[model samples]
Target: MKLKRCFDLVAGLIGLCLLAPLMLLIACWVKFDSPGPALFVQQRVGRHGVPFAIFKFRTMAHDGTAGNVPRMWPAPCITRAGHWLRRTKLDELPQLANVVLGQMSLVGPRPELARYVACYPPAVREKVLSVAPGITDWGSIKYRDEGSLLAAAADPERTYIEDILPVKLAFYQRYVDQRSFWMDLRIIASTVSTLWR
Candidate 1:
């Protein structure tokens, strides 16, 4: 775990440094493309049941519900820039800051909103939250097109809660039980390849 933390810190710092220019360009584009701030922060359940602010590049239009529970895909609130950002997964770039702050990991179970975390069985919750949340994970890689999946659902949130969440929980448990430096590297590589494709 110590080594993992060290890797996260170093990788996070390096990522932020290397991507700073691109991130700044994206931020500016987001700002000019919409009426809202470039960055969005929302509360998320972290390791040990703690709550932390998760950061992202704002993809939705400015609205009172922006920080509320994530809405289903193909909703009207998304801005023009949002479509491209979400499609390219650039919306998640800001989470590198979360990684640098020790609020997240480079590879682990992705964090969830409090409401979703509350739905987890006690034992499952305990196991999943044992490690810090991450920007990328096996669950994330598998569901890279999650928005499209939700778009096809009759009740997106329900499908998420009843179906997707369970599968993600299982993946999370698997990650928790088998996590190591090499595993993290593989997950990261998988994520990058998934994105590249």
Candidate 2:
């Protein structure tokens, strides 16, 4: 895990350097395209269940609900710029800083909203939160089109809590139990491939 953290720190710095120009452009576009700041900061449950602010490029309209609402796939207020950013996953670029800062990992369970963390079944939550939350994981790969999947549901939030959340927890626990450098490499490769698809 020491090596994993070292890789995360190094890769995060490199990623930020390489993607800085793109992030800047997106930030500028978001500001002009929406009525809110370019960055969206939210409190998320981190390693050991500590709260930390995770940063992403603001991809929803200013008027959208600030709460950690479950159906985040599509909101009426999403600007045109935000839509493309989300589609390409460019919105997640800012989180590289979180990686550099040691608040996250490149390949671990995705961080959940604090409220969602609170709702986690006790044993599952404790096991899942044993490690740092990550930018991507097994569950994320499986649910790559999560927004569209939720949009197809009759009750998106209910579907998420009942089905999606549990599956994610299982995957998270799997990662927690089986995590290693090679596994992280595979997950990174998978994520890159998914982004290209």
Candidate 1 C-alpha error for residue 193, in Å: 0.8
The TM-score measured for candidate 1 stands at 0.98
Model 1: lDDT to the true structure = 0.92
What lDDT score goes with residue 170 in model 2? Answer: 88
Put down candidate 2 lDDT per residue, 81-174, tens digits, no spaces.
8778877888888999999999999999999987778879899899999999999998988998887788788988778889899899989999
lDDT of 1 by residue, 1-197 (tens): 89999999999999999999999999999999989899988999999999999999998888766787484554677889888888889999999999999999999999999999999999999999999999999999988888889988899999999999999999999999999999999999999998998
> For model 1, which pairs clash?
none
TM-scores for every predicted model: 0.98, 0.95
* Candidate 1 residue runs with Cα over 4 Å from true position: 71-74
